[model samples]
Target: MPSTTAISVRNVSKKFRLFASPKERLMEALHPFRKQYHREFWALRDVSFEVGRGETVGILGRNGSGKSTLLQIICSVMRATQGEAHVNGRISALLELGAGFNPEFTGRDNVILNGAIMGFSRKEMLRKLSEIEAFADIGEFFDQPVKTYSSGMFVRVAFAAAIHVDPDILVVDEALAVGDARFQRKCLLQIEKIRTSGAAVIFVSHSLETITSLCSRAIILENGIILADGEPKIVAEQYLAILFSESKGEPNLDITNERVVGSSANQGIQINQLRDEQFCDVDPSAWAGSLSERFGYNRHEVRTTNGCAMILDYLVAGNGCDDISGVWSGNAIAILVKVHFSADVNQPIIGFELKTDKGVTIAGSNTFLAKTQLQPAARGDTKIYRIEFNTPLNEGDYFVDLGVAEYDGSPGGYVLDVRRSMMHLMIRRKQEKPFFNGIVDIGFRFTEVDC
Candidate 1:
């Protein structure tokens, strides 16, 4: 292993034997023919990857996709049937709830025990006990048996101990999911510190938001194989594609390419066609067949429809242009979505969201939340929905997602059609003055005040 590499796995594979019953195993053992009584199940196959110091790599996959198995091999909780994993330094792994803690031991003792297991001396662990306990903030539970702790308390103590150990490599596997929102935020901040301190972090979580936001790199595993590995955003997109295709019974990751039906843009039409509500009212029933040819249209957009409705066309208009490629910060923009319902629909809802290019959702809203009522629709019915919002965003390229669904009394309702990353909006600042520095401008006012 290179000096800079904290962890490396080369062609690692793990296999397990399955038998119908214990009797089958006994029979196979007694038979002189030595016939096999169990079939082989490969949990991981030829999985290889390396994590360098200061790099945070996220492992993403559905359940039974070898995620946990691969982590176990790296953490030495389980052995690989083939190949090996090398670690350049001590590892602090929070692979599962109560994984390292002894249920019978007090939380304080467990921390010391874990420190000792990681090669720390009793005096060293004693010195760090106060800090760990303060971070955990589990109150009296620190002196109580770990079995008395709740799920949330377990994560708090486990995460506190794991990070305080100062290992060269940190392995976390979905253990933070049990933490409360406040604690999760605290843990993420600490993880960021660990990452900056030059520790290699192998983080496994089903939360795509966290994966995209925190990890420097990402890997996708499927069926004991590495499906995709690279930049976090791209890998996340591919992972979503796989999930969507599988759920729809499609075996391939072919993105939906259904052409937008609309009238063509007139020859020599500018990309920023100034449009707003009046433009939409002029011809509600007319198909803007050429909307796809507009200058601001995103060719790489992903669209999904469930046969109930289809988003026929869309346009972004702002600052005196109907089709705008960019909007000035703090300016108001209108998004027009033309939809065609193929079947009778009741209480349909339309939603809109704004996101950063890295896939972080900045803001989103739906008709249900606004308590807006729409008339029921029949087959062949067509309507145009308009969403208007102010762009208090920093200068950068952003994306807009439009979705149509039913208000089925569920938290998310039922999605009928979705156009993700379909509309690209560029937020521009006046060249003379750049107002904000980050992803958003929260309208901060500065004034001198006496303390």
Candidate 2:
């Protein structure tokens, strides 16, 4: 049996008129008379891709790289300036929250309207209304006008409606970022259910984790062009590499450099080995971990019943034994990460990325897939997550990258904790053998025991 093709977008492109003067737009519209539009802004340039039934595909790009424009065109919320798009079934879109909503109408009213536009009948809407309400969790406020609702409520209701409509094709654009943690996970689970139910999906998101976890394939977009389209990890890694490569040339000059000031510094008293180590070890405490590359831009912004807590004090230690940062090239080492949790977080996973002195991500790993959190940690709670690996890194200065998240099998729901630049480790070459292949010598093993 062959899979059905659900969507086809051929050479789709969109262009907008840019006017140097505000009057130019007015003048051009009034034309019978010609106008003075200075330039044309091509939001999308001949972008073409196809989606198969039951397949989830991700479109990734920078802030203004046409991902949204492509989605809007395919979902029929907007028309293409050139080329054509074809969809084989009823389409549901979460392109923008409250997009087709009438603010004057109550949330309950718009829920039915949006579902009806999605091809659901009033009876069908009523049938799924409970499911939508359960997902939204907005309470009696559902009877209030949507315009008065919060951003969170708007997205919750919108996502509930989109999924409840049961369209044959679903187009989701970063709507996962809309609500709180529990809801985000709930949304991802629903998306998974939808995909499994045979609805073709076109998902656009910056969260590579989400893309890789939910979609069978991923595509990268740059400057309104398809940069790469292939496996999720390969595409996500490439995106991260390019993102850091861009971070190297110009360290956001305008952005204030927020240092991980040790607890002692803040408390006005030098306590804990961390403050002491910072003074002695030129590298900060954040770099105390053996693998730091995994944590690059790995910060999580976690919200709990109490509040939010930023995970800090990442310490990586090797078998060199004592210091979390202590490790010599060619020696057995254990990578350890210590994080301070501010609130109760369930199933928090920790990992690291190893970066060379030049900001190249060498290798990284997290317990997310391999293992699960042993316990839920609360405010002022600290835990150590450790991974042991044979010494494989070259002798050089390297940065440690860290990440923390409530492990939901899908990637989009991660609440970034912290991406700090404090931890730095120096590996001294093994005395007898200084052979360096690249960043790490991933020791491959071969055992010759009789079977």
Candidate 3:
């Protein structure tokens, strides 16, 4: 069934005014100048989308891409010069640190104040006060003014209060990015709880991993317009494609910067359709062009990859099946390999490997693991093989590597790593259960007792 729309935005546009200089503003204040010495900046333009109830949507873009402006508009912190935004329920907005906070007031006072701003009743805030205190972990710092709190403390206290207030919609900006790692994880847990209650979430972040993991759909904005809005994987891929296209992306090959991903290994291969003979392990450096030029390995950040080979194919099912992509966690899918024999090759080692988008292999099985004929044929002959398993991936991106080699390992194998795209799948929780969200669904047994 289609989810119900909880939030709707139609042709929303926001613009800001900037003064040419202090002198211009002073003159304008002293006496209205006939010609205004200011320029108008449009942060957002004609953006429209509907978010379903319980949907977690991510807004991703480069800095100054209007992501923050969009969030602020949704939260109603800033007014749009034109267009419309309808927020249907109570909101928990974790906007910039202390946007609604009193700088000179104690954290405790601000918690109460911010909670009220979120539409929490005085009695309700009192009841959830302990929960906020526990989650925030600010200790005595809660007694001090918010201005005295560190960036970490500011976010923790603010986030804890925002979520614990029982909001029907949540808006998170990049504020959480300032907190330490441990605190970030804690904040995610809280957000997860809120999402399970059928709340709408609008998360804005530059962190692709977080967006891909937590959201079902993602929006990529550039300048003041929406670049793309669809599946998380495709949107992220589109972003990657544009971020590091051949002509204009990541430095070609010789990335002396240690930040480059897969910098050390020459993992050169473009992920096209998959075949058995396609797997060839060759030095990426030895490939046709620069690694950076050939593939998009720009900006080596964690959760980003540098050099890696991968494969893509139609994941099949049924007795004789062929299907791939759009599979979710807990779904069973088959790995179908088309083995092509050339060079009078005899028995070709056919195998498959699955890796995190970061290039870490979590699962791999080959003809060696199964200890079978793998496959054998004369020149120009091709055959098919199959492997099936349960996919227990956490919500994120994954790549599959395919290969074929000789047992002697004389570099006699052709390993083609046309890495599969990072996969994005949603895992829905069961009804009437204590809800949770994360990788792997751990099936648990519970018995109810009636007295």
Q: Which ten residues in a row have the lowest lDDT in candidate 3?
A: 263-272
In model 1, the worst 10-residue window by lDDT is 251-260
Best candidate, lDDT? 1
lDDT per residue as tens, model 1, 1-451: 8999999999999999999999999998899999999999999999998999999999999888999999999989999999999999989999878798999999999999999999999999999999999999999999999999999999999999999998899999999998899999999999999999999999999887799789999999988888878888657655654553313222233222111224232211123333334345525454554454343456577888898988877777776657655666788988888878888888889998899888999999888888787788777888888899998888666888889887799744688899898776666665565566777787788899999
Deviation in Å, model 1, residue 386 alpha carbon: 12
The local lDDT score (0 to 100) that residue 432 gets in candidate 1 is 60
TM-score of each: 0.63, 0.58, 0.58
The TM-score measured for candidate 2 stands at 0.58
Q: Candidate 2 regions off by >4 Å?
A: 1-3, 30-35, 247-451
- The per-prediction tally of clashing pairs is 14, 28, 21
Best-performing candidate as measured by TM-score: 1
Candidate 1 all-Cα RMSD: 9.6
TM-score of predicted structure 3: 0.58
Cα RMSD of all models vs. native, in order, equals 9.6, 17.2, 11.3
lDDT tens string, model 2, 1-451?
1348899988988998788888877877788857556688888878888889898998877788888888888888789999899998888899876688899999899999988777778998898888888888999989899999998999999988888887789898887786898888888899889999999988888776588778898988776777678876556645543453324322221131222244322221111232324322323344444222222223222223223444434444443223333355766655545566776777777666667767788777676665544577776676666666565677555666656766676642365464534455545454566465677777656799998
Query: TM-score of predicted model 1?
Result: 0.63
Stretches of model 1 off by over 4 angstroms after superposition: 247-451
